[model samples]
Target: MTNMLVYFLGFLLLVFGRCRTSLGQYSSDQCSWKGSGLTHEGHTRDVEQVYLRCSQGSLEWLYPTGAIIVNLRPNTFSPAASRLSVCVKPAPESSGTNVYLDLNGWLRPLLREHEQAAGLVRCFGILEGALFIEAIPRADISRRVTAFQYELVSDELTGDRPSPAEACHLCNEDQLLLAVCTKDFVARGTVTSVREDTKENRTSINVDIHRLYRQKTQVFVPGGPRARRWSGSITMPRECALKVSDDDILFTGTLRFGEARMGCATRYGDFLRWYRRAQRLGTNPCHLDTD
Candidate 1:
């Protein structure tokens, strides 16, 4: 399957060239773009250009009539740029457009209007190309909008797993070490409860955090008893079989679509043992206070 995708991408290069688009009236902040299709009211085939330079942002188009090409270029350069990916989650009400990965002039369908309304997420490597969102032609364009939130994700954190079962697998020691430093949130906590959402095929775990080591986002809030401790929830695939436990566990995960995702988790005692061992060997990737 991957080979097929690679072959297709290669085929796209045969016809790859710049797309001709007319400028449309819109407002952008380099991180996000909001525009109206009414700008192309009479020009049904108009294609607008949109560029975003942040690691994450959003786009909203009202009264769709034409198309827009979104160019995503994060504000930094690194050797790991090739390992970056863009993940977009459409708003539940998003409609009237088909999203595509545009490699110059070639287009690969990524999502349809119906799929967008389902609020599904689609991800592609940064090298795949730009997003081309084309509105579906219709006589009535009222009450239609194409909207979604996008984020730049690291392949290491996502594991790039092809299957749900693999996505739930525990990371090895090396990955665990990197996860501690790269994951959005790392905390020591006890699982208070676990809830399963059959509709979403996910499990949400409620935690009472004893220590907040680091967090990229405000996933955990200070609460419980004079606001001394933090409390939050971490989401994981139901297939992982996570259960509420009294054991103190080290939680590390990334944030996706405003939710924390489980990554590498181990009992506090186990982490302390391995961390102490690594410390003695002078191979600890990063320092952490186990006490």
Candidate 2:
């Protein structure tokens, strides 16, 4: 709308003060303006028109606040789709490919459903220059698999999303199930030599732990190729409650920054310390009440 543009121009005036020079910079349209919302009356596909001109990987998002967030990066899983960022796994596990729906697209709805970060209807932030809703989506995803996509046939997406309790790593029943229960968890005994699959038998108690104190920061500096040192018995837990298997586990017991973070020699010393005591995924320690 002309009026909206005028309002924006005024907003810019407030931000930048007066124009730099009084030369020929001002256009006839700028001299006198009236408010009018975007008029696409003659346009057949207006949405595609305005958005098509931007970069290939970017997405334009209009917020309720009259602000917009543009996604500067392409969707990692599918570059063709719009995305904020891909949660990648570390070195050894990095080779595996997995993807999750960007929370920027689905989080608000999910949180409103679960009442986690409610009252978030009016929230805004810039991620990579593009505006995005700052809300958490209930990403109960286990493995990377195409979401069950189809035109919405029902109008009931307004409440809590369907229960996403099933662990669905690897597109198979065995791995999926194993990723959930403690069954697949393993350990070795010098004496008993027992291989216990706690998968079939396990008990889970959601301990909403609030404060997991920062234990200690271990520096993984230059020590050559021997930088990584796992303590507290490092091995795939006999069973993983992580249903999303195919999707790379960015970090396991500890945080794992992607290669970018790995390659920066200058920052390795600093990052190493932060990595030593990074928090991990599990039940929320302090559940932020939404309702």
Candidate 3:
């Protein structure tokens, strides 16, 4: 998608579901999410929200990071799948580790020290009678960036497999993160997933994914002069909610999760238009899902 298209679509997302919005309302009424180990703590682990939709017989939620595995395979459960298994490993060093065996797809693993990336997920299935394995680059917010500016890249991001002989390199996880630290929390990325199986009688992963997601609010701060003022990007949790002033005044407004990060035409005005737009909306419908 064009950058403009992506931003515009994101704008629409920020504006959806609000019928009564005001310019200066501030409340914790619009943001929430759920997952084990997910946190509001700055620079710690992030929350990954997913969704799935299907008939009453369908089952959703797959993939390793998000699943419960038994003996290195996704678990066989009440859902009556041909089989299911989930697994997690230190980013692997070879094609020998078939991540697809866990989720039933061909995935190449790129092992960055701080962030292991699978540059793409190769999907295959037999439909009617034809079979295909199509490779798609990983484009999600979290996994897409395997390298960073200003950081030493130990190894270039290569598709399919990690080079055991090459050192891994990644962006400084905290550089962008530290830019937008609030007194008590940090904003993180969103996750959307889809899974599919060919059998019509069975619950497909993709169909199941649709019902599992609800939109979530996340926070971020882009770098500029504002970044220099802060000692660091991370907002370490403190008693009684760490106190920090929101100089931009945008944080005081009732903005949804992803809306606060966009920049306007000029460096200064982008945040203003974005914040004003956010303030104009109220009470995102998905806040409660955080719990």
Number of colliding residue pairs in each model? 0, 24, 28
Which of the numbered candidates is closest to the native, going by highest lDDT? 1
Error of 1 at 238 (Å): 1.0
lDDT of 3 by residue, 1-291 (tens): 699999998888655522212122111321111222112222122223222111111111111122211111112224333122111222222111122222333333322233323322221211111111111222232331111111001111112233423212221323222223321222222112222222211111100111111112333223323332211121111211212322221111112112221110112234334334444574221121212
Question: Candidate 1 or 3, higher lDDT?
Answer: 1
Worst 10 residues of 2 by lDDT: 258-267
lDDT of 2 at 75: 19
**Over 4 Å off in model 2, which ranges?**
1-66, 75-165, 168-229, 232-291
Winner on TM-score between 2 and 3 is 2
Top-TM-score structure, candidate number: 1
Q: TM-score, each model?
A: 0.88, 0.20, 0.18
Clashing pairs in 1: none
Residues 9-120, candidate 2: write the lDDT tens digits: 9999765432121111121322211111122222211221111111111111111111112232321324323232222111221111122223434433211212221211
For all candidates in order, the CA lDDT equals: 0.83, 0.22, 0.22
Output the lDDT of residue 290, model 3: 19
